[model samples]
Target: MEDSTHTGALLVVGAGPGVGMAVARRFGGVPVGLIARDEVRLRAMTETLRLEGRTVASAAADASDPTALRAAIGRIIAELGGIDTACFSPLPPVATIKRAAATDAEDLLTALALVVGGAATTVRAVLPGMLARGSGRLLFTTGSGALHPSPERASPAVYTAAQTAYIDVLRRDLSGRGVAVAHVAVVGPVGADGHRPEDVADALHDLADEGGSTVLHLTEGAR
Candidate 1:
């Protein structure tokens, strides 16, 4: 996705260790927004980036909460000027199991609801601003798990389905707009023993190469 245009800022929803911080640091010196629940952790990250001469900002909100997310993104736009890129890494707790038969109803529903519903909330909140500008990057971090469900794992089929559907919605819904929706199709564990966040950030930033329509992938594992 190549573009002659530029964005005012980048907003990251799940500001965690791997991809989240990596993306922030990649654009650290620019006006950026960090949205996550752990204020203490966020403050530490902001402080670190500031010490490194990055003009970073922060907003606290659980992406799973509709009202809180709206307020948080609203504040980010106000502080960061404008969000040209919205990256969602909403790492709400997930129920991973060793066997499919062991999955509980509560765990399955919660996971499915959060991933599907939360993705919807984030997309709805960000796309309007993105479309108005006609040039923006809306990114979501996804893993190999979304592509495939292992029978050995006690994974809820619904969770995987919802995630795939969520990505498809972005791909299909935002085709004509100048906004570019991309997914960091993760292949392995997010942090250690897999592709690093820095690597993923590099991959995502490559979207700058072609800035039209929507982009997504199931990278290494088709799961």
Candidate 2:
């Protein structure tokens, strides 16, 4: 079911030490572009991948800033030639946990901007090209809290749920248009138990090749 043709750069937003690096490693030979907020870590990741003989480029941008994030994406496209596949995994460790009633408005908005608005902006940047070519892959890494909301993670749950809803609509809107929109929900610690980052990366590649939208749930016991 994997498409043999359609070679283009894989743009990974929120490229960090975990899912981002793992995905790039799984798709080793392809040209890769990484986007993250940390310039030092981004550079180091690029160099690490380059040492493996993988063609890689990196740019740093805050996901909450749409203008900057899109500009960074443009640089990646320019550096890697083109992008046909994109993976978004931007969640960071929660600094402060709050109940829904106690959460601040700005905090909720910030969460939405990073998780939902950020993805929208990135998609808007690359979608035209993909739609023109009639082929592309968009994958988002979602937290399990979205599916199973918890009072402890009230803020993230709200934004992530919104993100999931948005992806659902996007998949429907782009149906039969050759774009694959997928949501991969993380139910537990990414590398804990049998849920290897490598396996998650492999699944993402498979989804890209298949060219359809679907939800994939990964837990400790089930990959």
In candidate 2, position 133 carries an lDDT of 89
How do the residues 63-92 of candidate 2 rate in per-residue lDDT, one tens digit apiece? Answer: 889999999999988888768888888854
RMSD of candidates 1 onward, in order = 4.0, 2.6
Looking at model 1, the pairs that clash are: 1-209, 1-210, 1-211, 2-209, 2-210, 2-211, 99-154, 100-154, 147-223, 148-223
Best by TM-score: 2
**For residues 1-223, what per-residue lDDT tens digits would candidate 1 score against the true structure?**
2222454787888787667888876654467788888889888877877787667889887777878888888887788777787777767455554467777777676676566666777778777877887777777766556456776654534565577677767777877878777766565565555556677776677663243222234253222
Clashes of each: 10, 0
Off by over 4 Å in 1: 1-5, 96-98, 208-223
lDDT of 2 at 136: 88
Instruction: List where candidate 2 sits over 4 angstroms from the true fold.
Output: 1-5, 192-194, 211-223
lDDT of 1 at 71: 86
